[model samples]
Each structure stands twice: as C-alpha cells, then as structure tokens.
Target chain A: MHELGIVFEIQKRLLAFAAGNGLSPASIASVVVEVGEASTVIPKYLLECWPAAMDGTDMEDATLEVEVIVAQVQCKKCGTVYPYLEHDKICPSCGAWECRMVTGQEFNIKEILVYEEDVPEDGSLGGDPAVR
Target chain B: MVKVYEIKQRVLANNDSEADALRSELKQERKFLLNLMSSPGSGKTSVLMKTIALLKDDLKIGVMEADIDSAVDAQTIATTGAKVVQLHTGGMCHLDAGMTRQGLEALDTDGLDLAILENVGNLVCPAEFDTGAVKNAMILSVPEGDDKPLKYPLMFTICSVLLINKIDVLPYFDFDLDLCIGRVKELNPDITVIPVSAKTGEGIDEWAAWLKNEVTAWRDTSSSETIIAKNKEYDK
Candidate 1:
C-alpha cells in the first residue's frame, strides 16, 4: 500500500528531527499527526504501519496519534464559510466553484514529545550518588 | 536545574516545498501537464494513444506512463512517435510531484509543447496528490457504472475534464449516459465531459481537437515574454 511509503517518509523526518535536536535513543514519547479529509491517508493503515516502521529504532515505544481535519471552504459569492460534505469542492450555500479551501488537505506531523533522563544531584551523569 | 521544551514541525512540509518548486518549474517550461487518472481497464492507455496519433503532427507531445510494474502502455504509445517515458512506481498507488519532476528531467522539455502523465490506475490515491499538473483529467469506463460520479465524487470534482470511455460498449452495457452526465455535472458543473471509445476510434477526433486547443491556448499564453519572465521568477 501507499501507506508504507508514507510511513517511511514519516520515519525519515522523525529521525532527522530527533537527531537534529540532540535527542538520544528512547527519548521520544509520542508523535502527533494531523490529517486532512481530502488526503488519501487512512489513519488505521498508518497505525498499522507504525510498529514495522519504528521497530529496532529509538521510536519503537513512541505512540502515534492521528487527528482528522474536516474539509472546510469559503464561498466567494455569499461570503460564507461552511464544512464540505460528500467530497464536493463547491460552496454549498451559494453554488460557487471559486471557493477557497480553508481547511483539510493537510498531512503533517505536528509534534514530538520527548522525556530526558533525570539528572543526578551529585553532578554525575550515570546515576544517583546517594544510592551509590 | 535545566528545562526542555517540546518543538513541533511538520514532517511533510519539506516534501510539499519540493512539490511547489516542481510546480513552478513546470510553469516556467511553458508546459501544461495533465495527469490522466482511471482504473486499470478504463481505456486510459488507448485514449492516450489515440490522442498522440491525432495531435503528433501539429504539437510536440510528450507522455509519462505510470504503472505498478510493466511498461506495456509506454511501449504501446511508442508507436505513436511521441516522446514517451515509462515510470515504474514499484508499488505506490499514486504519482506525486517529486516523481513527476524526476520523470520530467528524463524528458526533453526544450521546445516541448505538452506533457501528459498517465497516473497509476486507481481513483482514490491519484486524486489526492497534485503532480504539478495544470489540469487533472479522469477516464471513467462504461462497465464501471454511471453511479461512479456519485460514489467517487472527489475524482470527478477535482478533475477539469472527464472522459467517458468505452462508449462503443454502450450497446451491451446498461450505462445511462444521461444519469452519468447529470451526476458529474451535479458534483462539478465546470468540468468538461467528453464521451468516446478509444477502441473503435469513435469520438476521438473531437477529444483530440479539444485537447489540442487547450494545449495551444496554454502555449500561446505561456510564450509571452512577460509571462516567461514572471514564470522564471516564480520558479526561482
């Protein structure tokens, strides 16, 4: 499926971002993605692809969250904005085809949450000095 | 003693930017790329062949054929004597702008007139990506049923031209022409619908003539020095 390729792209971007930010292995907690209704991406398919894509990687345990953005458009004739239904690209209220898309048609990873290892009070990078 | 902040960045933004660049490049080349979409047995290949045959004498035609594996369609069109490139998607269901740019690089765009890309046979995924094409054209065969416009409204709505393929099969099939046109118009009144049979070469002259006119008009508009200057700036 095309989802596999998309998953690969996502992993590539995620790794690039994590490496750029000096994040270590196993630091990522979750990845939040926003998908638009017009996009062909199926959330269920992307979720199914997550494990295979992240396997043996730092993001192995990271959670994947997908948010759907409903299609919305602005009418040129009536100056009204409304949610698009039935995949119709026209403004429903005014029957205008020159409407601009206000929302939807999005496919992006919005955020990545990571947790750093707790620091030791004794200024040692390895562990707690009190226990040692 | 230290604090860390979460930062969010869009992963696909880079790809979108690349696609935008490719779109501008196409505009600068003064080429109107049409991404033709349809199902496997939808006569897309034949229609393209007919189109090339009719317009090759007058226009500098180029074609990019996308397939999951084989280059059969490209081979078939080679007979038409157009500049054809075969793109093997490997497994992808759709052709994106990046792939299109890659394909175009392999083509001779210097003094080229029109470039037509035949997308992998699938209605859903192909409709999602913009392949830097000036217009999106879709072919719907008769056996696929007249209700397809209502079911797959996105493909019809986004398309500028809708070619009703396999018209010669109308005698055997129960495809209601009136209902098909009605539903497509209901979804997108601005879309130009042309009915034809690529097999028998029936109604193909009109289709080719319309295509030639559209491309000629685009070429005329793009050939102006002012438009060329603006296009170069847009590409940069």
Candidate 2:
C-alpha cells in the first residue's frame, strides 16, 4: 500500500530533521502529521503503517499523531464557503458547482514533540524528561 | 524538558522537489515526458497503442508501463517496436518521482524524443504523486460515467488534458459528452478534453498532434532558463 511508502517518507524526513536539529532519533517523542479530509491519503492507513515504519528505528517507541483538516470550498459565484462533500460540491448560497478548494487538501508535518532531556544511549538517565 | 517544534512542512515536499529536478533534467536532455494516468479498463493501453502508432513514424518514442505486477502491458507495447520498459511498483499503487527516474535511467533515453509513462491503473493515488512528466494526461472512458470529475476532483484539476475514450459506444451508454466536458472545465479551466474511440482509431490524430507539438516545443526551446520559465508560465 502507498501508506507504507508514505510512512517511510515520514521516517526519512523525521530522521533528517532530527539530524539537522541535533536531536537523538530516540528523542522524538511523537510526530504530528496533518492530513486533509479530501487529500489522497487516508489517516487510518497512515496510522496502520506507522508502527511498522518505526519497528527497527530508534524512534520505535515514538508515537504518531494525525491532525485532520476538514474539506471545505469557497464558492466562486457567491463568495460563500462551505463543507465540500457534506454539501455534495454544490455551493449552498448560489447552488454553483464552480468553486475553489479552500481547505482539506493538505498533507503536512505540523510539528514534532521531542524530549528535551539528552537521554544517553547507554541507558543512563541524567534527568527525567518532563512529559507534557 | 518537553518541546514542540513547529515544522509545518509538506509531507510530499521531498517528492515534489525531486519531481521538479527530474523535469529540469528531462528538459536539458530535450526529451518530452508524458505521464498518462487512468483507472483500470479505461482503454489506456489501447490509447497508447494508437498514440504510438501515430507518432512512432515521426518521433523516437519510448513507453514505460508501470504496474503493481505483471509485464503484460509492456509486452503489448513491445509489439509496436518501440523501446519499452516494465516498471513493477513492488505492490505500491502508484509510481513516485524516484521510481520514475529509475525507469528513465533504465530506458536509456539517449535517442528518444517522447517518453510516455503509463502509470498504474489507478485514478486516486497516481494523481497524488508527480512522476516528473512535462504534462499530465488521463483518459476517462464513456462507461465510467460522466460524473468522474465530481468524484475525483484532484485528478481533473491537475491534469493538463483529458481523453474521453470509448466514444464509439456513446449510443449504447447514456454518457453526455458535453456535460462531462463542462464539469471537467469547471474544475480545470485549461484542461483540453478530446473524445475518441481507441478501438476505431478516431480522434487519434489530434492526440498525436498534441504530442508532436509538445515534443517540438520541448526540443526547440533554446536554453534551459527559457524552458523553465515557459514551463512555469504554462503551469500557472
């Protein structure tokens, strides 16, 4: 499935980001990915593939968080915005099918929650990383 | 301590950049790459056969048939005597920029003028990923109904052209060609919709002409900067 490939892509980016930020791969506490309701990706599929993607990595213990964006559109005729599929792509105000997608097509990495404490790889904890 | 870093980057940024890079590389090589996408049984192979037959006489054509499994399409394309490569997606539903680049490398595009990538027989996922093609086109058969544009808006929006295949069966199927084109145009103002019957070789000349014009434009562009600028303007 493409979700597995997507998970691998996420893992690659996370590793690169971790390296660039001087954070241990294991220091990544969680990853938050924003998926659009109308985007090609399925949130459930991403969730299903996350664990397998992290199985052998240092971020194995890390968790994945998916933020969904509601699919909405702005009617070009009446300047009205409404839920896309909920309204069956018809503008409520003008009953127009021509509109611009305002949201729900985004697939982004919104943020990453990391443990600030530099836990050693040798299993010795210098200080307890506060979980917030 | 716990911290939250606001990355706010697109998950597909990596693939997009790679695709852009590949596009530039193809431009430098003076090759016109076309990415053809459609659902299964949309007459994609039949359209490709007609397209190749029409253009192979004038252009050095190569076809890359991508599927999750099997080389049946590739074998079919080989009968046309054009350079063909079968790209197994390793069970993935679509081909990404990296996979497309690998196929191009394997195809050895030294003497090719037009390289067509027949993407996996899928409508949803293939539209999500860019395969480094100069232009994206998809076929929508008459039997698939006229409301496909409504169901798959992204595919309609991103495609440069739409080929309405199986038009020969228009009398049997209650497909309103005008309505379908109108719906697609509403989503994509610039999409060129052509009705054709791959089985009857109708309207293939127009499709071939479009490809020939694209190949000529891609090759006649003198400098890389001009090509990039033109491409950017065209994309807009």
Candidate 3:
C-alpha cells in the first residue's frame, strides 16, 4: 500500500519530464527503476502499482522495468567487502561485526524513454508516423 | 525514420541525497538520534513511555512519533511533558528521512538533550530507510515469539539495540529468551540486548539508564566549545 506513494512519485516525475520535453503524454515507452535489496521495496509490488498510478496519465502505456541491486558491506578491520545478508551480520573472512555497506539499498528511477511524434514538412506534428 | 534513445536516471537516489543532508545537519548539531523500530504490537510505545517517565526530569528529551494512522501516541507522550511531535504517515508503512527532517524542523531542539524517533510500526520497511538516527533500536515483544530474530534477521542485524519486551508474559508463553538472544547475537554480535517488561515496570530502569548514558555521552562529546565551533564551521 505504501508503494503507491512511491509509484505516484515516479508517475509524477515521468509526466513532468514528458511535458517539459514537448512530448505528448502518451509518448512514453517505458520507465526504468533501480531498487536495492536493503531498500525493502518489493519489485513485484512496485510493478503491480505502475498501471494504477499511470491510469489517467500520459504514461498509461509505459512499461516498468525494475533492477534489483544487492547490498555489499566492507569490513572496517579486515578491509574485505562482503554481501550484507540478513542472516549473516559478521564478515565471513574476519568475523568482524563492524562494516560499511557498499551497495544495494537503492531506489531510483533511472530513465524514462519517450518517443515524440514526428513533425511533418508543413511544420505540424503528425499522428502515428507509421500511418503515412 | 526510426528513433532510439537511452537515458539514465536514479529515481530513489533523490530521496537518499536529501536524507544525507539531514544526517549531516543532525550530526552538526551534535545530537545522537535513535530511530526505534518494531511491529505494531511490539511494545515500542510502552518502552518509550516508560523511558520518558524515568528520564524526563533529568534529561531534556524530544520525541517524534510516526504512525500510519492516529495521533494517539503523540497525545500520550504530551502528558509526559516532553517536547514531542506526532507524524502521520497517512498510509505509508515506513517513515523516511525526509519525513524525519520535516518533523525535526517543527521540533525545538536547542534545549533538547536527546531525541528519540519512534518509527512507524513495522520490521521490514522501516529498517530500509535511514532517518538520520545514530542508532537503530528494535523491540520484540514476548507474545511475538522467540523466532522473530531468525525470521526477520534484517531487522535484528541492522539494529544497534534490541529490546525483548513483555517479559512479564514469559511465564505464560513459551518464548525462549536464551534462544532468541542467542540468535540475535549470532546475526549481530555487536547488538545490545535488553529484556524489559513495560507493563510491570520491571527492567525498565535498566533500559532507561542505558538510554540516559547514551544521551549523556553524546552531550558530553558535543558540549565542548571547540567541537561546537568546529561543527559550526563545517556547516558553513
């Protein structure tokens, strides 16, 4: 349910981008998002929220792509980087409990690809270029 | 003609950047904030109420209560006479750093000695977001059972302090204290575990004392004019 807020934000951003770029609301092809394992954001849940969020927006046809990143932490004492699994808090190599996370725990929309309607020789925008 | 385009953007990174700014700001104030996490019935509110009752007169305290719905907890804390703010997440299961920053802005921290943020009740989502808190503390109520540490290892592992609440019910329930603590330690050896029963007020003093010492240490470190000056300079 909370994912809806995030999905709304994503939709808002995509729409604003499309409007700013002089692209029609329906021109958006897809939205790419990056999520970190530590972020606690379920990819499937976020994807399921995309359509409802885009319902009345120009990006209704846009596809959502989610990339999950694993969180990696570096041991302060041993200088070893290890995956920070929920079950294992200690460094496998040195048994160090103190460590810094290097990766994962990311939630961001990386890109939105929008296809603009081609302008005709008369300097007017044409509809569905394929029809010509 | 055909068109192909690729653009790279990080969506959630924006929130992280803002959170980083808030973290720096809190650190500059020389305040060590603790973000307490737990499930709805995990005894977070009880522990906080008891803690405030014990330390309110001695330490300048501030609290931020986050909940998906209701200002009930905030109203409850106001009776304790501590500086407090109630944040309604509306419907979000987690409270992010931006929300914490907004709450901090409304709080008067100049005279505050310690700030405790009671994060929205949840084990999964709250642990994922950083609220610019120095420590992440979690509570596991006895009724919730001893297997929580294993099932929700992420919450246990990320927490700096783990409180086993509702110990008074231990006799009534089959909760294995040693097993729970052992599992938590296995996942996070550095985590400090405290068994408490807020209902009976037993073991509340120890938790309160631990919190007092933590806040005192932070205050002592930040009390120096030299450090304060350095922090001011860093902020500029």
Residue-by-residue lDDT tens digits, candidate 1, B3-107: 223333455555656665765676667677778999889999899988888888888888999998987889898888888999999889998878988888887
DockQ of each: 0.24, 0.46, 0.24
Worst 10 residues of 1 chain B by lDDT: B227-236
Span of 10 residues, lowest total lDDT, candidate 3 chain B: B227-236
- Candidate 3 lDDT by residue in tens digits, B63-97: 99998778898988888889889888888888777
Q: Which candidate is the best by DockQ?
A: 2
Sorted into a CAPRI-style docking class, model 2 comes out as acceptable
Q: CA lDDT, every prediction?
A: 0.76, 0.87, 0.75
Q: Compared with the true structure, what per-residue lDDT tens digits does model 2 show for residues A2-47?
A: 8999999999999887886667999898989999898888999899
Query: lDDT tens digits, residues A12-109, model 3?
Result: 67666655555666776777788888666789899888888888765678889998888788887899998888638688988976665577756776
- Model 3 chain A is weakest, by summed lDDT over 10 consecutive residues, at A123-132
Q: After superposition, how far is residue A84 of candidate 3 from its true place, in Å?
A: 14
Using all chains and alpha carbons, the TM-scores for the candidates as numbered come to 0.76, 0.93, 0.73
Q: In model 3, what are the clashing residue pairs, if there are any? A: A36-A106, A107-B12, A108-B11, A108-B12, A109-B11, A110-B9
Clashes by residue pair, model 1:
none
Worst 10 residues of 1 chain A by lDDT: A123-132
